[model samples]
Target chain A: MNVAVTEPVAAAPVAERNDRELAREELTIARKYIGPFPIVMAAWGLGNLVCWLALWPLVMTGTLSLWIAFPLATLNVALCYLPSHEAQHSNYAKSGEPLRWLNELIGYVSTIPLVLPFKTARITHMDHHTYTNDPERDPDYGVKAANAWQAILTGIRRRQPGQPNAYGKLLREKAEAGDETAKRAMMEGLAQTLSFWAILTALAWSGYAIEAALLWWLPRHIGMSYISLFLSWFPHHPMNEQGRYRNTRHFHYWFGNIVSFGMEHHIIHHLHPGIPLNRNAAAYRELRPILKKRGCRLDGV
Target chain B: MIGKIVQTIGPWGPVLFGIGFLAPLIAQSMEAMEIAAPFGLSFVQTGLLIGTGLGLAAKFRGRWI
Candidate 1:
């Protein structure tokens, strides 16, 4: 019996097929959670404003104590970073929509307490996500590589004159390279920095220096330090400039997850930047098997 | 009913406790600033008691972390 020879169909490469599957799964999961994120952002953003308004009168009237105000203000300021982070990802407003103006507005307002220019921060943070753990490329490397104390000290040191660090240098280089986005970011950053100093000077000139120092400056430092530790040092430290999974760590503890607004899932974030913060836990669960199979490291509380 | 109450407060339990715990120090600071203490109650003692109560509730709620 003569059997006709049949041609075997060729299958796609295993790695390519797996990557496509992973992308599809991530997209589906991300789409499910993206709608609610803007609402959460608005709630938290407005909450921060309300807290500031309530506390500001008390602060001005000397009703709110430094001990209380410090922690509360610090927490508020730290929380502000989250909305700005969401805006940075264009997740605060829907993508390709007119409401994107709201995202930029929210980003700028949210970062005001921290004295961070939204444009500059957004660009630098995007770079951080793109080049995580890269000593040369990541704007966050100096802070991430240092211990908490060192990170704090380095932050102080970097603020001094003639002490341009990696981030600043990169910003300057990008501006010099005729990058319009970077140029606008640098201009905004400088303008915001100057405005902050001008306000502080005016405060001192008007004899509210003590109040400014106690209520504003101190809390900003505390908030900055808190963010430095949680976002930079804890998530990326002790990891080399390896590819995504190997370089970032995930936190399983609820406290960390809540306070960080689900940012504790840094590895998942790096692996899937499209996922919103509110759904990070769900995404983590969905991707946990894949992550484990890929041997990703888990860290932090 | 108790489980429902615990479920209702959710993660806010610790946050409320934390606020209550800070109230005493806040009261003292207000006193130093010559702000009149509200309601004639000892803010510190009151804050501590409220904090402890919330802390207990939080502990019961199992969301204190």
Candidate 2:
């Protein structure tokens, strides 16, 4: 289905006289929720270290069976990565500075690109919120470019107006307008893809070619990529009557929760971005009636 | 530290037990049932029960104890 191409609409300008006043008010509210950033940062970091170290031996030695490895590693990503996500939001720690540091650390160590600090992610994420589900302007919107074969076949088919592929249309608009987020995300994704492949190369250089191919290198890039894609993408596609609700499906299974950190409660998450993951269930329960009244419900797991 | 660890694992209790542990075991049990159609028991069934039982214990601990 073809969705309208949306451009970034100019934000309503804050009156110069009121902008500073509003900033102060927002800061006060932010401070009430943002507690001692250092303690939270230290605690989260320590907890992250413990979890990773706990898994290191099993993963390194290959003592755990492949099935166990799959689940454990996925869990590990949730534990460690959620903290990173929280850090990005500046919510993990009550303090802002420490959260920035934590996010920066993760950005560097994380295979993903360090696109921005907490403040930036928060701002950009908020922008995502305001323009959410907008097929064109939503930063995360875009389909994988069709492969050469598909592109050639599509050309031969000569798709009629309003019948062009959704992905092809999105790509065409993204290229023409040169969306900044799409460019930045592609750069980061490229960097991550290369860094991961480099590890495999290093292992080959170290004479553990076969082991690396089977273990760290292949599973993370190949298997983990597939897992990550499905976990991240499918739930948030076009799904609302207004096509505004970001596709967020919540699954109440342990594996599902661990895989996405209850991200499946995605609709609720989009509605209440500040609610901690740990508190989502309670919040969801409380908000259920209101959501139902609005005719919104969580979709597939 | 122990308290923190418990706290760490607390919020995830339902998921760890109900869905994560139980779902797989149920799947396995079904598979085993198919394999051992005439037998009194099957390895898959045993594995499923063991896995689910452990998960159920964890879940019970999380919710009640």
Candidate 3:
């Protein structure tokens, strides 16, 4: 007589396990709209250039005074950060394969005005996304300061020697860790900085020095300051340091979204980086209910 | 043909297009200022400067209200 042996139930089949994983992944798919992205970016670039070209002649001729041209130029310069931001995310040109290089090239060219290298910006930005509001770890902690003024002050302080700036220190650590990407970013940063100064020096030697200083250099600095204040500081100031949903602010103003390229819906971006810039608002609308349940803060201009 | 154009020009197509208009404008501005061309930048430098400037402006406009 054979003893009745109870066989243990076999584990879930491999295909079933794989199916479960696929289902979980599908739940995270974001709504993405990429049409008109390339056209809009191109138009913005062309418009700014046309504006500058038109203004330059008028300013030199005294038909349009510097007092007028200066502000307009500053506005234009400040706007340059948006395209570069998109480029950093590799979301500007969303056609197909072989377009990755186009994304990177746009990023680099667009950031030239800010004297920022694409790789450095990208690496630091990735860190910002990862660490978010952690004062000790986030590269963009200055942006999450208690107030806008505090954020600006923090940025200034961090740039000073001996300050515990997470971004700079993290770059150093990454280099020491033998991260090739970090190494390349550092080298690019140095090279870009030098290139910036070299261009300025060349301009000064060429006699268009004053023109370059006033028209080109000064506006970029002002634009950068504006970016730090509005883009980084205000949007992130009220965000909680913990949890993905609580860590970003969403603004529901159409005009604001238009100007900021849907940056106002930053919460959606933080939650889903794959969504293109043009589609952030749509994505936000889709996820609003879930985000609301999670206690995400919504604001407007 | 469309893919070829996009690939060849890449993301710089608009910028290059903008430069085409900007170069002449900068040259005119230099003439108005009576400053002789420096660094031999007659057309190309102006195009670059204006193109870069415009790109920066577009960036700001996109973000700031």
Candidate 4:
């Protein structure tokens, strides 16, 4: 991806006279680009998962070589998080809506390969949105680090038995305080984690150890690194700034937007969680000028 | 009884990780390199022995690196 960033130009002040008119215009433009239902994201989420599932059978049955399947599986795991992210925002359908079930279905089913619990992901992501760069409260704060390797290492360290994981720690504290939603998140997280290990252990013991490792375990670590790097760390790097636009930046990743799962337009998502993932780029294209005028951290486009 | 066994095992994670994850992977790579374990032991058998030993060490001692 083409990760690009230059020094952000200091924003020009909005004149009081034109501020209201400009703000109204910007709001109208943004709403127009909320765009259509994320059909593409839904397909990407489901199809990537199916393709990952198919890899296991193909490798086991000798239809495909492990050498090739490993990369494909890694790609699948990396692709796993975005659709569910859409679900986290309730971008597909709002609460009490009929298609909410579809939103929930995609949310729950899409992340199975990564073994992330839907409710857990949802609650923590909402926290992330609410407290994007808060060191103490943001569930993603653990991903903050000096560089990419540190970010990846931080992701790994958090999963180690005794190491502190921000989301897990937050959920545990909330559950202890008798928060019902936190309690559900804890249960789902535990079940998913156990299932992941149990299945991996069973497969390994049955002599598919290499397959299990490549298909799920290692891929999970790699995918988490990718997700954490692009989704959390990169967008919100030097993550101390507060407020709507300052907390996230628009930068082109060296690997390009696709590899980063279109997070290059992440600033837009933070500003309007309702904008579907596919529409962020187009929205950002239109909204960039307004963002610049407001002194958003639009370092790169 | 189950708790006793679980306690006795201390941490089963490293042990399982060693045998289930580390061992087989190492064995596969070793075999690919045309290397063989000493005493005519199969590569996987050697890996299991080593992985279990290390896993148990980490289990009791806490931490894997």
Candidate 5:
């Protein structure tokens, strides 16, 4: 099922509200937004098991070293976990406690195998969806530094600079100005990332140190970052067209489909997050005619 | 182009596939170690380990392609 669009209109801007007050609103909305939780959880659990079982033998064997295991491991990561992302947005099934449970389950397995907490991921991911590309508000919304050297220097800078990030500045203003929900979201995101790492450290302390590092931390934090950099950077390069269909290039094969989990239909996803991954093809088919009429076409895998 | 084609499918493909084929055998060896308890790692574990290792190494040779 798709992410249900119950109300497609904008709500009031969250400004000057207290945390408790905003949280109450968030809870009310979150309850409605959080759809099928159980099915998503089970599906993710089974998918994770299959991926681990399928590749673990290879890694356990001398035949596949850490290098080979890395890519094969990602075969499941992009495919298996992306659906969890969709589920987090309550797109997997219709709304209910069952949906919430499924979201929690799927979110937990997908990242925890890599040692991230479902609680934190869900919170940050919600921020990501709501704030999409809004540099002033979104956590994942990043900007290019003035130059390559500036960017490199910034990474080594070790502090949120006096010349703040656009998002950081906005968040600072919002917090100082008493935007409770925004402040709470920012705080929760910080807590979530911190908690995820804390859990990872604890897992390492527990006997499964190697597994914890390889399966949990390295892939989620390191490997996925590298993959995302390449995926995002290339697609949004200056040479790419401004038009939707021409903006991104699809690899156009089963491998692409398996890897992206229908994200290759990028434009459609932005237009309608409610469309399920399985239904991406049908959604594209239906929307293409209308979109093309408006001088926009969605590229397919 | 021809060289790229040959490098990929001719040599690289077989080597990767060979590794995939031998993965189960290696797993069997490692699992066998625990299974072969009490008698230091029984002949079964040693044989499986050595056999799988040698088989994979042989497969890596250019002639195997």
Candidate 6:
């Protein structure tokens, strides 16, 4: 009669043991934020664009001071991308839905001043989500760098003549394959570029160079850099891992959420793209426990 | 033809890109501020800048392409 003994084994940590349970719990919480049509985003899309356009006339006619118009221009250009971004994901309404026109309309018009074509942005953005830290595949992978200057400089470097462009290559491939949407994106992109140069050149010749430079030229460059810095680089720095949870990070932005464009919750956006930009913070708060359990890189939570 | 011109420019591609973008920017700034074009050839500068821009833009697939 031999005595049998239970094998000694270590028990899993509390959070580790409850990972599955927490995921299910997290989904329940996330579902609560799915939608009721965020009208605020629509207002932001239309309002910011109208304000950006109005800058031209106001400054051109000397009705408003360039000193004041400059800052507003930067703010408006930076603000323009988000609403279109929301519309890019069809956050307002799904395809074929009755309100879908509003989504398309907002997507197209909101980015006019920024000189980005919505279809181009949407397609490339979808690719970005699919391959966020994958150097070989992501159109946005060009922005990955060790620091702010590197990331920003890389953006400029990649735009230099004869440099390889990930976005362009991908769009070209898709368009060559006869994807109608991609073709439209390419055309719109060309059109936007011509329009930007034409307007700037025309204004310069017309004696409104200061107005053009302050209101659009400088602002667009600054705005693009700022967007690349916060949206692309900060949220996904050291962009090494490709795992869903590990690819993106939530870090403390000392500048606080608003000045940082609410990007501290960008990890939440990557995880749940359907959540409107404004709701990511609240959802992140509720889903923190599960994210931690999932071994995500939440630095400042 | 633009692509050929771009290739002919060779290593100066970026230089052209810079000049093409900055020439107009500077020329106009001078005009707006009522300063001279340094060479006093504002119209000549204008034509060259436009020509450079069109060349850069032709066969352009993306930014600075």
In candidate 1, which residue ranges exceed 4 Å CA deviation?
Answer: A1-19, A35-37, A94-96, A252-255, B1-65
CAPRI grade of model 4: acceptable
Interface RMSD of each: 17.0, 21.4, 14.3, 2.7, 19.3, 6.6
User: Which one wins by TM-score: 2 or 6?
Assistant: 6
lDDT per residue for candidate 3 within A134-189, as digits (tens), equals 77767776556676567767665544323454555677799889999888787777
**Candidate 5's error at A140, in angstroms?**
3.5
Per-prediction TM-score? 0.71, 0.47, 0.65, 0.87, 0.49, 0.84
Worst 10 residues of 2 chain A by lDDT: A111-120
* DockQ for each numbered candidate: 0.02, 0.01, 0.03, 0.35, 0.02, 0.28
**Segments of candidate 4 deviating more than 4 angstroms:** A1-23, B1-12, B24-34, B40-45, B56-65
Off by over 4 Å in 3: A1-29, A34-38, A42-65, A92-96, A156-166, A252-255, A259-261, B1-65
* Residue A162's lDDT in candidate 6: 70
- Lowest summed lDDT window (length 10), candidate 6 chain A: A1-10
Global lDDT for candidate 1?
0.67
| Model 2, TM vs. native | 0.47
lDDT of 2 by residue, A198-226 (tens): 55445443433434434443344343333
Off by over 4 Å in 6: A1-20, B1-24, B37-65
lDDT, candidate 5, A1-301, per-residue tens: 2334454333444554444444344333433423323344356556775776566556555556756666656554544455566656666554564556655556556553443344444555555455554444544445234433443343333222123334444555666789775576456545565565455445433433344345544455443443343333322322224443344433343456544445555555545555545555555554454445444434332
Clashing pairs in 1: none
Better of 3 and 4 by DockQ: 4
**Against the true structure, whose TM-score is highest?**
4
Reference-based TM-score, model 5: 0.49
**Quality of candidate 3's docking, in CAPRI categories?**
incorrect
Model 2, C-alpha of B53: deviation from truth (Å): 49
* Local distance difference test values of all predictions, in order: 0.67, 0.45, 0.62, 0.81, 0.47, 0.79
